[model samples]
Target: MLGAELREARRRAGMKVGALLEVLGFSARWLSKLESGHRQTDARNVARLLGAYHVDSETFKRVMDLCRDVDGGYLIQGHGVGGADEVSAVRRHEAAARQLFSYEAVGVPALVQSEDYMRELFGRSVHLSADEVERCVAARKARQKVLNVGVPVKRTFVVRELTLRHLSGDREVAWGQLMHLFWLGNTRKVDVRVVGQDASFGYWDLYSFTLMRSPQFRPVVHIGATPYSLLFDEPRDTGFYEESARLLLANAMGVEESRAFIAHLAEHVGESVSA
Candidate 1:
């Protein structure tokens, strides 16, 4: 998380990594490893870098706090519960992002999931009580607020067609979520597409990931793991996810076709429930 902030500070300072290295008199390889979280920098080095970048005191404190939280580790992992440091880190990135790209294979993307769908999702957690489920749902809704802020988040989503077919046991919930996706797709803020089962990238069904981009920071990718979500800011990791998104988009249905497809599915689900 500190590395992500450092990269953001460098970008905000209008200094490329190479240029920053020249200014700091550090080797490119050293800076590279530091920024990618492969090598930990001492507090003195961090102070020097912050001074070089002219970062504000408040931001400096926040970055330092994050550094301590991670124990100099690069990855932040936490359960989906609210108020955890990992959750806070993810929220910070989400709030900062100007653009969000997401791919989901088995479930709906959180940004557009309906309240009913979300509630059902959280309710399924064996360990969560009714109140805990509500809290988690509330936290998720708060995350979606980024989409509606003054300058709304620009979003692109690629979902597997199978995701449309698999209902979370409630036809109304499934219909509501699909209609929500369809509605959002028609809006200017989001572009939603679906990849058919026969698409070239069928293997993408194995995982779900999100990439968030902001003018102030380097792109960050979040991969959902079993017990925790893994956050990656390293160029190699982010690049791999970016390329994966590109490949998925290449084979996904076009915006209009995807909207039509979602509408068709929602209608089918509605009819099924009526029948």
Candidate 2:
């Protein structure tokens, strides 16, 4: 508990190995092992490390509690095809999550990509080089494998009408993606919703967003815009985000109605309909 906090605090304070060792009265290698979690720490050593890092008693106790809780909170982060750093962080979180929720407006959640759809979309994008686009699409498809048949994770997706109309590549690709959503709606593992544009709710207009729910780390919020991807953890700020999410679900079309909407869209795009 103390060791992890101590290591991060030392790094933040810009303390070198020799300086940290001299200040803590421990050998450099010993401190390194402790910091790395290779050695079990006792209460006395925990107190010493806390003192070395100048961590207040209340904060130190909070850190200790966090270390002890195996199932703490969710780890949320920003992610997408255009947001690589955000994508990588989300990939890690998705692998660890037991349940996932997303709210989207513009682009599709890369977490549910089909290889064909990705290729088609990327093929049409001028912003990305062929190689870069291929890698991005492939990574997204790989991430989607977690939602494949027999996978235990539960996924819920909420999308608005504007996002549904925003096509990538061509009408064919857009229709295929819509069909895929319909199929997923029928599946037992997914809960799909479509929020109508006219369905008024007391929530801010967001570009797109994702929320990962787990019984383990603090909830993570990730947002992206062009070249910037931001991660947020302040609960007060996220309070509205959560509230908006609930309102979206409240105002969104139910599973059956959403499936019907997808079916209607597929027919509009001239696709052979199963949904």
Candidate 3:
């Protein structure tokens, strides 16, 4: 956790690893190992890094505390989610967030995915067993409840048009997921948009990210890629993602247009199955 925090701080500070090494008089490999959590740094070194990043005192203390906890072999227990460390962290952030903004290059957002869609996704994981996949799907379903609890979380999703057209093996599952997106998009606190494949402003590469913000803490950005995931809380890092989201939204269709697009896809899928 401390390593991840440090990495985010460096990025937020707009300092490249090489540039940081030049300032700190450290080897590139050493910095790499430190950021990757392969090696540990003492408090004085941590303080110096934080100083370089211009982190506020309170945030500095919080990060130092996390470093201490990790050094003392502390472990965070998941809420029966059975996910990796990154997944657990993302869930915790989600629970705390009053607002969430997410972008997906392909497939549906996890929060709105149908059970069958989730099952299909989990099933594709080569290492997971049937039982493990079932457990994960159940856990995801439980996590979705946060959207409807007390005061619903305000969410904005920007998904690519290609994602809407992609179908899972089960046509019913794909159709159901699209309908679920449609319902959620029409909800008072939820906004869903879609970026067309031909959008000139869209990124050339596929990327998925989520930004979560809460009243109690700084905003966090979560990037989930296969085999690796990252959670960033640094202001600069989170701000960068927020900017990226803004760009994506600028190119994306409006909520109503996105809804219409999803409905059309679902209708097409339903008709094809009927045929």
lDDT of 2: 0.65
Candidate 1 structure quality by residue, lDDT tens digits, 1-275: 66667877887888776777778899987776676556777777888888888889997887776666565244656575653223767866777778889887778888778789989987888888998888988888887776777776778988889888896858988988898898887765899989987887545446788889876557888776657767767686687788888788889999999999999999999998799
Candidate 2 ranges beyond 4 A from true positions: 1-82, 149-152, 271-275
TM-score of each: 0.77, 0.64, 0.69
After TM-score superposition, the amount by which residue 180's alpha carbon in candidate 1 deviates from its true location, in angstroms, is 0.9
Candidate 3, 1-275: lDDT as tens digits? 46656876787789877777789888988777676555778888988899888988887887787666554322232333346322545666677688998777777778878788888888987888889888888888877876876776779988888877885657888888888888887765789888988887544225688888775456677776555456656565567787888788888888888889999998998887788
Best by lDDT: 1
lDDT of 2 by residue, 196-260 (tens): 87888554546477665544344556665555554444466557677777777888998889889
> Residue pairs in steric clash, candidate 1?
none
Tell me how candidate 1 scores on lDDT: 0.78
Superposed model 3: Cα runs more than 4 Å off: 1-81, 84-86, 202-205
Per-residue lDDT for 241 in model 3?
A: 80
Ranking by TM-score: 1, 3, 2
